[model samples]
Every structure is written in structure tokens, then in C-alpha cells.
Target: MDFRLTDDQRALQAGMRTLLAARYPRERLRAAVDAPHGRSEVLGTQEGAGAPGVHGAAEPAVDRRLWAALGETGFFALRLPEEDGGAGLGLPEAVLLFEEAGRALLPGPLAATQLAAGLVPGAADGTRIVTALDGPGVTAHLASADAVLLLTGDTARLLPVEGGTGPRALAAAPFRSVDPLTPLHRVRELPSPARTAALGPAADAARLRREAALLTAAQQLGSARATLALAVSHARHRTQFGRPVGSFQAVQHLCAQMLVRTDLARAGVYAASLTEAPAEIMGAKLLADSAAIRNARDCLQVHGGLGFTWEADIHLHLKRAWVRACQWQSTEESEEFLANELLMDAAGENAPGVWWDTLGEENVQA
Candidate 1:
């Protein structure tokens, strides 16, 4: 695939970016963080959202209107088939939207919800919030999710988070995320006699994982780019001694390195989206995590003491980046996955037959 944005895609990107910048301002985000868990004013939460319908759903952290607005924007239904009342887009378009969401620091289980559009009832319309889970034992956004897809050893189970009386008790309690705006609740303790709406085999689970990693990487890419721009902006304006801070050679070098990392990561993410190779996808995840985390830190360094201040908005990006870096696949896991792939190739036919066959097939494909 070309990876170049088409006319429609560019317009979509610009529109989404403009909307998020206007609607989800820094002040609004801060207010959301300060507000109570289920009553975030920024998101226009319901009084006691505890059911499927959004009309009277109370205690919702996300704004009902905002969720509807997202549905209108085709956020949740982006990749679902049009025949199935979806936008029927593809992975590329979906990733673009995700990138903008990350740039705006939009909170919630975004990737999971998107995937849920096809599975969870009312998800495509944004009436239901779906959390795509990586593990069965524990997951995030449990309290907010209408449904949860638990992946355990290549099998996927679509578990309902709601019950006839009210929302099901899927988790033990909510945890305050490092990124205050992004509140998290894990499924530490499960309500007994759990029920699943559907189930799928290993292939389905694998596909879900791919989508999760790819979309997450896109989000990280957006954050990296945003931080790069921030550092550049600060360097250009903030002054030290007599000249602008950006005029300093050290600042220039830092900015250059940030740009390089961000661009390389973008390339990797875009490529991974096009090609479904496991190694390539893992490589993309590695690059993206490095770019987001490293760039956020470097941007902070450029900002000096101001970066450390609570009032500064830059730290929000850094915190979110830090949180995301650990989720999905950590730096260590990505390295190990890639390292093992390399080792398999290096081993060739020297020892294990299984490893040799896998390496041999991969070589043939390449």
C-alpha cells in the first residue's frame, strides 16, 4: 500500500484534529481529571449511568453526547462493514483516526471500543462501550465497558459487563491512572457465574491482537509527533542568556534526534499496518514505544523546570506516553519477541526442526 494520505484521508485528519483541539481543550481535560470518577463534567457524564441505554445511564465517566458525536464521526464503526451498518473502512483509515485521538489525548479504551463495534451490540452506535482485553485474569476500563473481550491463550470470549439489574460487577475497584484524565479500573475480582455472549478460536484472537497493537502504535506515533512539535515550539520561543533557547546547538541536536525517532517510528507503524508479518508488527511496536517515551522525556528536558510543574500540559502527554508504553506490549516484551525471531533465523537448521521449518518458510516469503 502507498501509505500516502488520500484527499479524503487528509480532510478527515484535519477535521478530526480541529474538532478535538476545540472540544477537548487542556482546561477541559484538567477539569475531567479533577472531577469525580463517574461525574466528569468534561465528558457530560450521566447522573448514574448504570445501564445499556444512554438516555438515563448514570455515573458514566464519558459524555453521552460526546460518544454520540464520536459515532457520528464514524469513530467506532470505522472498520466495520458498511453492509452491517458500518462505515466499512480499513485498517489504514482507522489508524489515522486513532493518531488524531492520541494527539488530542482523548481518554478511554479507544482501540477496544473500535474493535467492539463489530462484536458488541450498540457499540458501533456508541451506545455501548467495549474494552478489548489482552488477558483473561485482568483488564482495564472494566467499570466503564459495556462488554469485554477477554483473550486467553488464543481464545476470545465476549463477556458482558452489564446485567439485568445493572452493570455487572466485572472488577474489584477502580485505580487512579498516572494520567489522571485516563482513569482505569481493572478486573481484579470477578462476579461469580460469569457469562459470555460469544466465543471465537485462536485466529480471531490473533487478529484482535494485531489490530490492538497496530492502533496503539498509531496513537503512540501521534503522541511522539505532538511532543516533537512541542519541543520545537518551546525551543524557538523560550530564551536563555541572550539568544532564543532553540538557537543553542544542544537544543538543535535534541530536536533533530526527536524528529528522527518520530519519523522512523511512523514509518515502522505505517508499514506494519500494511503488512501483517508478526516480526514487523513487533518491530513497529518497539519503535513506537521508544519514540513516544523518549520524545516525551526529551521534550520535557527542553522545557526545563516548567516540564516538572503540575500546571504544565506537557506532562500530560508524557504521563500518557509512559502509561501506554507499559500496556499492550512493554519494551522488554517487544525486544524479546524480536530477539527470539532473530535467534530463530540465526539458528537456521543447526538444531530444532520446528524452528528450522518456521525460519525456512519465513525466508521463502521474504
Candidate 2:
């Protein structure tokens, strides 16, 4: 079984990296963070003065040009079938793209928009921005979205935004966000949405949730890898006591630990992408969330006091990781789900030991 990336996959990853580097440079990211509402300024406007539907401050949190560029690259449409005018890629490809997005800390409702491609009109072309309500309560980037996807149990509803309708009609109030790039809106109550599309049945909704978890895990993996790179670069150049900080044993150990966590999480993300199993996806997200958060902390440690400054990108990575951790599946929820799977497996006719022995026998024959 070959685990290596194919030529096309490698190309896709490289292309996304190049695009993000050019379009969403660190400078651009910092500027976006500093801007009052993305590129727009709220002079004396109240909190919800011109939110999405109300017509006050509808300034989107994302850059329209960059969003269009992503669409031109077929980012949101990556998984749509070719017959549907998409790139006709699979989940693995989507994961690769998301990992690069994470590395760059690209802003906006990326996962939601990507998931909306085939189901929502104009989504595939990136003309329409879509955000999702993962579970309930606050939805990220609601002010910028053209539509909202509500996943309630087995049913997935697509609510279009027009003149204070859909999610806007549900009484979306602004919530102070921790990550500057992730603008959140609190949904007080879920009004019966003007359903534009009822996407498939229970099976499809389940698949969408699973896909979301997997892609988010991939993003976490990207952040872990990026932080590891940042730490390594900073340690190599920063001098202390007439020697590079990287030369010190303590710094080396920190970097080594970051590398281990990142690689381990990467393996899990890639494996889950292939299997698409609910348990494996949850486990991947668990590893990725930990790796992303811890790696960013270690990265800050590697940078010493400099990392604590607002200008430093390390804090941004840490803040974004913290936010991502809350999405998809929380640590406790993932742990509980994995524990149930383990107990169920152990109780089955194929005991853990037996399963291991069977695997060993197969490996021996091979």
C-alpha cells in the first residue's frame, strides 16, 4: 500500500501554498486583523448597525478579490463532480487545500464555503459565501456569508440570505470574537429557515459532518506544521549568549517535540482522509487539535519574549488554533466518542487481542 502522494496531489498542495503565499502574506493578514471590519471602517456605527441583512455595516470579514481568486482556482468546487462543473477531486485533495489554508491562516468561512459548493448556487463559483452552524449558538463569519447551512440531526437545510431572511431573520447578534479574523454572530433562536435546498437524507448529512471534521483536522495539521517551521526558523537565526538559540539543548528538545506531534497528527489526518470512518475522523481531529495548540505554544516558547508581542504571528496562530479547537468536535466530546468505540470493539466477538493477532498473521504472510 503506497502512502506517498501522487503527482497530481503534490501539485495541488504546491499550487495552494503558492497562491496563499502570494495573496495572503503575513502583512496582508496583519492588515486585515487591524482593519475595523475587514477593509471597511465603522466611523460611529453601533454594533449591529449594518450587519449582513440589516444594511448597516455589511463589510465582509474576507477579501472579495481573494475569495474570487480561490474560486477561480476551483477551491470551493474541488469536490464537486466534473459534470457539475467542478474540479472533480476527492476529500484527500480537499484536505490538502485546507492544510495550506491553515498554514497561511487564511480568513473567512472556508470549510463551510467548500462544503456548500454543489448544494448552494453560486457557491461553486465562489460568488456566494456560505457559513454553517456546526452544532448551535454562534456561527462564524455570519456577517459576510450569503447563505447559512443548518445541519439539524439527519436533515441539512440551506438557507439563502436576502433582505434580512434566512440566518439574518433568526436574530443574529454580533459576538466579540477571540480571533480577529473569525467574526462570530450569536443566533438567539433558529427560526424555520426559508429552505432553498434540502440536501439529501440522513446519510448525506452524516457524511457532511464527517467531512467537515476531517477537513478541519487537516487544517489543524497545517497550523502545527507551520508553527513548527516558524519555531525552527526563529531558533536558527536568533542569537543568545553568542550562539544560536537552536544550538541549545532545551530549544532542540522543544522543536523535536513539535515535529513529533505534527508528524503524528499528519499521519492521522491522511489516514482518516482515506478511510472516512467516523471514529477515525474523530481520532484524527483529536490528535490534530492537540498538536496545533501545543505546537503553537512551543513555537511561542522558542521565540522567547518576542512571541508575546502583538506584532508576532505566533499569537495569531495560537488564537486561531484555540478557536478551531472549539469547532467540529471539542476535546472532551472526541475523547468520549473514542472511548465508546474502544469499549464496543473490545466487547465484540473479535476481541482486541484477536484482531491484533489476525493483523500480525496477515503481515507475516505478506
Candidate 3:
């Protein structure tokens, strides 16, 4: 199938790419990495007037200024209704904005805010807001949100955080994610006085996952591309055995494999973004997770020992990929889900004949 971008979509993508490249260049990224708190310095301030907690320990405070900037740019309101102070764009536009965010490795409560904006009353206008998701001990509930949207299960009332940021819970497992630029938080405790409201059975959750997965894939694609570039550049400069490292066939093969994976993953993500099917989205997520993780590893391999050192930025992509691979869903879980769906689609029955016999019959003596 021909998956061509419309003129408007192309324009939107170009604009976003330009904006991200200017705002989130490598210098800014390096600064964020070196910060004492491992968060974007632009988002360093706390929410309330009183003093915030230790900078480096907790989830880094939300960057309200950056949030406002994103909001003004119509990013937060991308998929919202025009009546709700949004640009009245659709999922496709949202995907483009998010893909840029992935590439830039932008941080904060973006996914949560985007999900909350339209569902929460006055949220679209960026007022009186609350947002949280299910993880670990947390069930599919919206105790803190003025409005809650559930993705997989039934909605329930969740406890609110006492002077805490949002819903706090423990991570189901330890995740050393690749994109350290985008921090991950484990849910520790549930909030009390769980206030809640029903938004009906909305597609908010599924859409959020699909968007997150596709955008993450795009980010991974960017990381893969960046890593490959870095590896090639290093190979050209670094010499071994009195020759450029790039001259080595092994290094050449690794670079070729990285390129192939990245291109295939990018295509999968783009295709998934154009579809609303849950299966396609899941498949895209699985393929992207594999591509990002493998590509990062290969890039590191290409860089040899230098890549393992802290000074090298290769670790950043590695960490980011690790975190994102688990977020929304793990690679293993997504693959299992996709397999089940495919089996069901194949009439939920096993093949009648042997694998080779089925093909052999078609070319038989007749």
C-alpha cells in the first residue's frame, strides 16, 4: 500500500522538525544530561510557591514554562476539539508533533497532559487539571483527575497525592531505559479521597497508547539514525591496524544492519500511525522496540570501548530505549498480544497439513 504524506502533513512535519532542531539541539541535550537532577534545566522549578524537594532525587518538577510553550504552539491541544481551545487537528497531526518530541527527547508530563486535556473539564484551556495512569499497584482508576480515561480495564477511584505531584506508585519492574532525557517514575503509593468522574467509554486510552507507541518508534528511529551517524563518523576518524576502522568488513556489516533495522522500523511506525487498528499499533510497537534496542546496542558495538564510557552520548540512546521499550508495554507482552490477535484472525485453528506439504502440493506433478 502507498503510504504517502499529504502536503499539509509534510508541511507540519517539516515545521516540527525545524522547531525541535532549534530548541533541542545537542548542546541543550548535553546540558540537561550534566545537570545535578538529570532533568531539563528549563523545567527545574517546582509547582507550588513553597520550596520543592531535593532536585535530583524525586521526579523532576514539571517545566510549566515549557508546558505553556508547547500549549501555545498547539501541541498540547493537537487532537482536541476546536471548541475546546484546540486547533481541531486529528490523531495524524498529534502523531507528527509527538514524533518530533521523541526525536528531541523532550520530557515532562506530556503524554498525561495530552490525554487529560480534552477529557478533563477546562483542561483543554489549560486550567484546573489532574492526570494519572495505571501501573503496578494502581488499578485502572482516576482518583486524582478531574476526569479519567481508562485504556484497558474498568475505571475506579484512585487516592490523591498529599502535596505530591500526581498519582504515585511503584514500577512493576526495574527499567534502565535508554532515553534518560525522558525520565521514568515508579508508582509508590496510592492517594486518598479519590475524587473521580466518568468520561464514558472513550477511545482515549487506546489512542494514547497508539500515539505513544508510534511516536516512541519515531524517537527510536531518530536515535538509531543518530547513533549510526556517530558510529560512521567515529569509524572514519579512528584508525586501527594503520587503517580507518570503517575499512573493516565487520564494522561495515554492523552499520548496514543498523540502517536496515532503522528504515524498516520507521516504515512500520508510519504505517501504524496511519491506521486505527489495535493490532497494527501493537505490531508497530513491538517492531520499534526491537529496532531501537538492537540499533542502540549495535551503535555501541561500532564505537567499541569508547561507547561504554560515561562521556560518550551512546549511553543516552541506550537508556532511553530501555525505558521506552517497557513503557506503554514491554516488547514481550506486545508480541504476545499481536500473536494472539493473529491467531484469532486466522480462524483460531491450526494448519491441517505439514508446513512443507502445504507448499509442496501447490507445485505437485499436476
Top candidate on TM-score is: 2
Model 1 misses residue 229 by how many Å?
A: 0.9
Predicted model with the maximum lDDT: 2
Q: What is the Å distance of residue 54 in model 3 from its true position? A: 8.6
Task: TM-score for candidate 2, please give it.
Answer: 0.88
Residue-level lDDT tens digits of model 1 in 63-123 = 5567777887788898888898877778878878888888877877788888777677788
TM-score on alpha carbons, each prediction: 0.84, 0.88, 0.75
Error of 3 at 22 (Å): 2.8
* CA lDDT, candidate 1, residue 348: 53
- lDDT of all predictions: 0.72, 0.79, 0.59
TM-score of 3: 0.75
Candidate order by TM-score, highest to lowest?
2, 1, 3
RMSD to native, candidate 1? 6.1
Regions more than 4 Å wrong, model 2: 37-60, 163-167, 193-197, 349-366
